[model samples]
Target: MSHIQKLLFIIALLSSSVAFGQLTEDPEDRRDQGKDPFKTQTVDGQPLPFSQRLRFGGGINGFRFGNPFSLGVSPVVGYQATERLIVGIGGTYNYTHYKAPYYTPTTYNQFGVRGFAMYEFIPSILPNLYLHGEVENSSIQVKDDQTSRSNSVGVTAPLVGLTYSQPISRRFGVNLTALYNLNYNDPQGVSQYIYGSPLVIRLSFF
Candidate 1:
């Protein structure tokens, strides 16, 4: 071959070899084409891995100088639409009875209902910890049977919280959470709104 033709042939061969080396060195190039990053396949069809969870719990608060105590019940249900996002509904019921001096004994009952969507800042299983928040609408009703007086108030309560959960087994775990409540309404005539302090609790369940 002529000198110029030989030089051209060598350059073409080197260029092809470099491209071949690149194809072998990059592992991701062999992945399936036309694959969607946000979609996955399931037994039924192309569906996301969605999960549903239900939790119910009860707690009591006793007054320091009173015999009458408060009883509470809360039930929460959540659906995980993605690895780091959850949508949920929770409801709470509370009842307390007390007696005032020179007055008939009375009872006060509070009922709350909330629905929320939350996102996890850190999504992992091991030593699980995340920043969680929820916005909820709640209603409070105060009824006095003796006086035949009834009061009903509706407000929005936003909760900003942090939760950490540790797994003990496949069906059992423990979690601790701290939460703050935000109130949306101002007090009106003969109606007062009060906020309690934040709450911290440790929970264990199956």
Candidate 2:
């Protein structure tokens, strides 16, 4: 099996074990006896349990002076490292083009690796949402000849965001995230830059 499949299989085994123990501890219980141990979190029908997923998305932002346009793509693959904690590695690339009446057109590019972790605060809620945080190390470069000269910014900008995930079906879901700059240290010291959109909508596949 693939790595993700193996992980899901292992999680299934663990969850089944816990379920079996719970059943054994109280064999006389009638309410929880007939239910499937691997029951899913869905209203229409029981969807398949999800321990991992892959998300892809792109968008534009208004961070620039002249409503600069930006496009990016991220393939975030995540695994439930534990029941409450998930870990993932992903890469992102963003290219921003700027144009203004009083300023020269410029393009900024960034590429970096991303890491994510989440904690499930409540398990009773179906399609549980997680309180998430993330960190990324990006190599930022700018190409602007009309502006003054300064040192290039090649430092890491760390950010933290809250992520909410809701599974719509067995293999489809939506993830909304809001991120902010946690370490506001600009090497060039000319701007307070935000790393990502205030609200991001991600469609995921398992």
Candidate 3:
């Protein structure tokens, strides 16, 4: 008789817990369960507001002590394509000076336009790390020290690498990017606006 009473008590407690869970469960939470959080930013089955989807950010690159010194600013506008993806375009301008050992050096102005897409696909490597890819076209005037030939040419350089972002606020952060230029050794060659090597590293505020 006591065993039968204990079983009935256990069944009653289990039924009450289930009823309480159903009474307190959020409809929105239940709807979002098992759904991808990184899907396109949307709410209530519609797109997010315009102000939430469009954003502006930029970065600057400058170094004064080197064989080739470059100082420039890039201003960019981006659209949030998804929760983890951003696409943008930027304008680049840098004042560059190349000092050759045997030739006279002059300050040359370099201008560039760039398009970029960055995706935060891996959170395991580092939090807020992104894979960045860019294509930049920069125009510069060059003179060969060997032949003294001078010409102005535009070079299209493709860069692929990773960026580590440390967020300071909801809107701004510091970004450290390490990139390798795929076209650095191509016939078009590297740009005078870039830092000296095929390995390009940048510390910028965004």
Candidate 4:
């Protein structure tokens, strides 16, 4: 081959190699893609690696501090929709034993399902503080004497409030939320799951 032709061939080969290398990422770049939180890729306005962005947990539905002794749990599964928002679904099951001065002792069962959302107002300054909202439909089984609606009825409660999240360990955490049910004054007020108060204070764990 002529010297000029040989030189041109080498130049073309080197240029092609450089262009190919530019199209591919190095090992270091791949590592950064996974660990860089702020620069993460997003899917539908949420962070990528959807599975890892999920959190599974539950909350304390009720507890005993007075007359009607009760205990319950609200298991939830959530997705980190964004850096500051979380959305999830949960279910509740509560048992209460009420004993008053003149009335005979009785046991009540409450079960329900809820959809909830929480937004962190100041994640950088107060990472644990959150504004919470939810809507729940509860089925209560009560004696005919208690409610105007025959025996068993379903009540819908729409609530909005605040939450404080405390992470105990890598795998465990606690959430304290206070919610006000808008339907608290409905006809089924007597069958309130969290006592008879409109102001509900809840402490839960995951």
Please identify model 4 stretches exceeding 4 Å from their true place: 1-47, 143-150, 168-172, 191-194
Candidate ranking under TM-score, highest first, comes to 4, 3, 2, 1
Residue 196 in model 3: lDDT: 53
lDDT by residue (1-206, candidate 2, tens digit) is 99999999999999999765543342123235563222223222323244322233322322334346666666677665444555677776766666676446666677778777767677677445677777767776677746743234554545566666665532234666656655554655322332434343333332
Q: Write the per-residue lDDT of candidate 3 for residues 50-153, one digit (tens) a residue.
A: 45556577777655667666777778777778767777888877666767783356555667899988789876566588899999898866655456667777
Model 1 RMSD to the real structure? 14.1
For all predictions, the C-alpha RMSD in Å is: 14.1, 10.9, 13.1, 8.4
Full-model lDDT, candidate 3: 0.68
Model 3 regions more than 4 Å off: 1-46, 62-66, 100-103, 143-150, 188-194
In order of appearance, the predictions have TM-scores of 0.53, 0.58, 0.67, 0.69
Worst 10 residues of 2 by lDDT: 36-45
> Between candidates 1 and 4, which one is better according to TM-score?
4
Query: Whose TM-score is higher: candidate 1's or candidate 3's?
Result: 3
Q: Rate the local accuracy (lDDT) of all candidates.
A: 0.50, 0.54, 0.68, 0.71
lDDT of 1 at 127: 31
What TM-score number comes out for model 2?
A: 0.58
The list of candidate 1 runs beyond 4 A from truth reads 1-68, 101-106, 123-126, 145-148, 168-173, 184-195, 198-206
Query: Which regions of candidate 2 deviate over 4 angstroms?
Result: 1-66, 125-127, 145-152, 169-172, 189-206
